[model samples]
Target: MTTSSSYPDIDAQADLMVYLVLSQLLMRHLTGRWLTVQHVVESTHLWLLTNGGSVDWLQRISLGSRAQELAEEVAQIEGITFDVRTLEAAFSGYQHLNHRSPAVAAIYGACVAFVVERRTAGSRTGSEK
Candidate 1:
């Protein structure tokens, strides 16, 4: 017997799955995807703070609206700190370039990178408690 059906590319599937997850997460936690990129980024910030910051997976890139205090507490517990200034720069670029199709990808990528950087840094070192 010969194979007929083929499966999708693993990397493409992964990207789609990640996008779906992020889209739903952002929509559910914040407003909807119709909202401006700046609003989306703001929602992410609020969600992170509520979820107990980068030290918690819940706030890593999923359970966004968990609690600012919890985020800070976890970061403190992990002996890590959130870099506001670096993020502020990223956000500025994200917001400024809003309304452009090409920039949309750039904005989301930068924002995701920022969030990942914070979350990964803490957990990567086996410092999370």
Candidate 2:
């Protein structure tokens, strides 16, 4: 099992997992192995936590419309977060990393957004309570 020795922080692990999940989703989708998308997401989450990242580090991700709904519905079964949205917004953040593949850049951007949102929400809940 690979560890997060290179990325000791929760944020860093989350970021890496985001890229991993997204990239794997796209790659699997291209091969028509769509079912594995969810598996990849779940595996990535487990890998992160087991490798030294926090449980709260899992970021948001999405497939297509129906796929998104299925993910959300199944999430009720396990209380997981399966966010669905377009990659357009996330892709913009990685405009600087032209050398990387578009999918890779998009995942990186999305991870940053997800982590920021999670932190913001956590802060808000703390302030409210």
CA lDDT of each candidate? Answer: 0.35, 0.41
lDDT of 1 by residue, 1-129 (tens): 423233212232222222333333334334433334454346555544443342333333332332232233322323222233322332334323222333234334444444455445755786421
- Give the range where candidate 1 is weakest over 10 consecutive residues by summed lDDT: 7-16
Question: Which parts of model 2 are misplaced by more than 4 Å?
Answer: 1-10, 31-38, 45-99, 127-129
For residue 107, model 1's alpha carbon misses the true position, in angstroms, by 0.6
lDDT of 2 by residue, 1-95 (tens): 43545223445544554444443444443454453556556655545554444443323242221233332333333332233233222333422
- True-structure RMSD for candidate 1: 13.8
Instruction: Return the TM-score for each candidate structure.
Output: 0.24, 0.40
Clashes of 2: 0
Go through the candidates in order and give the clash count of each: 10, 0
Clashing pairs in 1: 47-64, 49-67, 49-68, 50-66, 50-67, 50-68, 51-67, 52-70, 52-71, 53-71
